[model samples]
Target: MHILLVGAGLSGAVIARKLAEAGHRATVIDGRDHIAGNCHTERDPETGVMVHRYGPHIFHTDDEEVWDYVQGFMRFMPYKNRVKTTSQGAVYSLPVNLHTINQFYGRTMRPDEARAFIEEQADTSIEEPQTFEEQALRFVGPDLYEAFFKGYTEKQWGCSPTELPASILKRLPLRFNYDDNYFSHRFQGMPEHGYTEMVSRILDHPGIEVHLQTWFDPAAAGEYDHVFYSGALDGYFGYALGRLGYRTLDFKRFTYDGDYQGCAVMNYGDRQVPYTRITEHKHFSPWETHEKSTCYEEYSRACTPEDEPFYPIRLVDEKALLADYIARAEETEGVTFVGRLGTYRYLDMDRTIREALDTVAAYLSDTAQGRAPRAFYQPPMG
Candidate 1:
């Protein structure tokens, strides 16, 4: 079977490798010049720092299968994401941990004391929270909400926290202890060689052919037995329904001498700050030593046709439009949608790989039983 795998990100690379290993010819194409998509990483020519072109991506997954699978491609160095944030002329730890609570209040409170204090500060009047603002008020109370989340969420999403869903804040933890690690996953690390090289190795299979800087032409779909699309769901159908809402990032890159900020990610939680966060690229790979460092001041805004879409804003209006696109995808033949952009969701690296593997298994099973593959492994509506 000749398979067309669009978008050479993790989704495309994993699926292409699986199909190629099963003796099927897989042609992988990406609009970008690189293979890793948003996870693309390259070394700075001057600074010698491994730069994450599209912000920082720390690989953290609790799934043992997904963790072991990535290890097959590249050596992953032990990395923990300890994020710092600045608010009102002060720097504190992120995720609203005990240390942050103690530092912000200038009091040495233990875990139990901090928990009780936060609960007391919380608004007991609101029984069930619907919006992000209400969720924050209910969980961490007004002070912490304004100091840590309010401004940052506004800048990141380009909207008031009151307008956003409570589910968004629900994912963020309000730690009782002093543990400042951003993620609670067992496996957390970054590729030693960089994400692009890791993905390049994934695509380096005998039966797989890679075509970078190539755009998918709908007319070309007929030439292949099946098409695995990881591109935008609306883009596949030429945005016939309407463009889905997305929040894109704009990066202001700069080079520095020695260390800058002394941390990997420094977030600005104040609305006065124009950019949301600053990432020091060299800090991402602590194993490698370098005198110079490269960093990016990231700003989030509404996505346009010319900009690269980063985060999907699946509000009520966008959901209705997405339903129309999903209907069209179901009616279409020889194409299966996969990955974040395809399904219109914010997915981590592990979730993307796990779904890709599942997609391959389903495809093989369907072909063996003489049945057509489903349009999606996970439904878009969910």
Candidate 2:
């Protein structure tokens, strides 16, 4: 069967490659001049540092199969995300670990002692937290929440913490140990050559034809046997209902002669700072020594049609709008919505690749059984 993939990002590349290996032809198209979507990376002409065109993306996942699958493409260097936050004119380790807790309170409490101390500070009265602010206060107390999460969260999402759902805060880790690794995933690393190189390798298949600067019109879906669209859900429908909310990022690029922040990511937890974090690209590839460094001061705001959408803002109103889009997608035939944007959710790289692989697998199975492919592997909302 001849399949059309709408985006040349991780999802499109992974799906196209898998479909091609399964003896099906896939034509991949992207609106951008380059492939790899937001994960696109290139060497700075002056600094000679690998720059993440969008933002820093560290590959970390517990899925062994997904990890092995990526290894088949490019080599991954050992990299752990030890994120630090600048709050109230001081630098502290992220995830509010034992080190941060001790330093913040001026008490070198042990693991158990720190755990007890945080518990004492927690608002035990709030049996069930509803908002991001409530979750933080209940778990880490007001002081840590205000100093670390409050300002940053407000700046990142462009809203008050109280307006955000509690589930967003649940993803964050509050540890009593000194382990400062940003993610608790078993495997954490970055592509040695960069994500763009890795994704390009994934799309290199005899059965696949890639077309850059090409936009696939939804009306042209009839030309192919099936369409695996990784573009925005509302976009496919021409935004007949409404545009789903998204928080887009603007990167302010700068060059530093020496080591910038001594870390890959240094988040500013003060709302007054404006930008969310500063990412030093050279630190992303620690093995490669470069005298110069390239950094991005990332600013997040409400996404407009002109901006590149990064984070999906699935607040109450957006969720309602998303439901309308999802319904429309379900009614549409011969097209499957896949990936973060298509599904209207914020997905990690590992989840995106894994879902793409599974989507193709399900398509093959459905075809074998003479069944229609599903519009979505899972619901957009939980």
Candidate 3:
């Protein structure tokens, strides 16, 4: 079988490798020059520090299979993401932990006391919270929300919290304990050689041919037995219906003599701050020693056609447009949609890999059973 894998990100690389290993000829194409997509990383020529080109992507996953799978490609150094935030004039730990709660209120309350205090501050009247604002108010109350989330949410999403979904804030944990680890996953680490090299290893099979800096022509899909698309769903259809909303990021990079922020990620909770967070690339790989550091001040805004789409803003209008695209995709033959852009969802690295693995398994299984594979392994509509 000749398989066409579009977008050389994790989704494409993983599926391509799987197909190639199964004795299928796989051709992988990416619009970008690199292989890792948003997770692309490179060593700075000046500082010799491994810099995450898009942003810091800490590989944290609870799935043992996915963790062990990535380890097969590259050595992963154990890394914990301890994020810091600046609000008003003071600095504090993220996820609104016990220490943050105590410091913000100017009291050394224990876990139980702090929990009770937050409950008292919370608006119990709101039974079922609908939006991000209501969810925060119900969970952490106004004072904590204003200090930690309000300004930061506005800057990050470019909209009022009231307009955003409650699921967004639900993902963020508010702990009464002092544990500041951002993710509560069993496996948390980063590739020692950076993501680009790791992905290169995944696509190293002889049956796989990689075409970088190449645009995939949809008309050429007939040449292959199957097409796995990880590109934007609307883009596959030439945006006939309308462009789905997305939030893109811009990085203002600068090199520092020594430690710049002293942390991997620092969030600016005050709306006065233009950029949402500043990432010191050196800090991401703490095991590596470097005299100088490279950092990026990240700014998030509405994605333009020219800009790279980062986060999909699944507003009501966008969802409607996405449904139309999904319908069209279902009717289209010989192509299966995969990954974040294809599904129009904000997915973590683990979810992306897990889906890709499952997609390939399904494809192989269907072929063995002499049945046609579906357009999507995981449907976009939940």
Q: What does candidate 1's lDDT look like per residue over 1-382, in tens digits? A: 9999999999999999999999999999999888999999998898989999999999999999999999999999999999999999999998889999999999999999999999999998989999999999999999989998999999999999989999999998889898999999999999999999999999999999999899999899999999999999999999888899999999999999889999999999999999999999999999999999999999999999999999999988999999999999999999999999999999999999999999999999999999998889788888
Which of 1 and 2 is ahead in lDDT?
1
- Report lDDT (Cα) of residue 96, candidate 2: 87
Please, what is the whole-model Cα lDDT of each candidate in the order they appear? Answer: 0.94, 0.93, 0.94
Off by over 4 Å in 2: none
TM-score, one value per model = 0.99, 0.99, 0.99
Put down candidate 3 lDDT per residue, 1-382, tens digits, no spaces: 9999999999999999999999999999999988999999998999999999988899999999999999999999999999999899999998889999989999999989998999999999989999999999999999989988999889889999999999899999999999999999999999999999999999999999999999988999999999999999999999999899999999999999999988999999999999999999999998999999999999999999999999999989998988999899999989999999989988899999999999999999998899887789998876
- What's every prediction's RMSD, in angstroms? 0.7, 0.8, 0.7
Stretches > 4 Å off in candidate 1: none
Backbone clash numbers for all candidates listed: 0, 0, 0
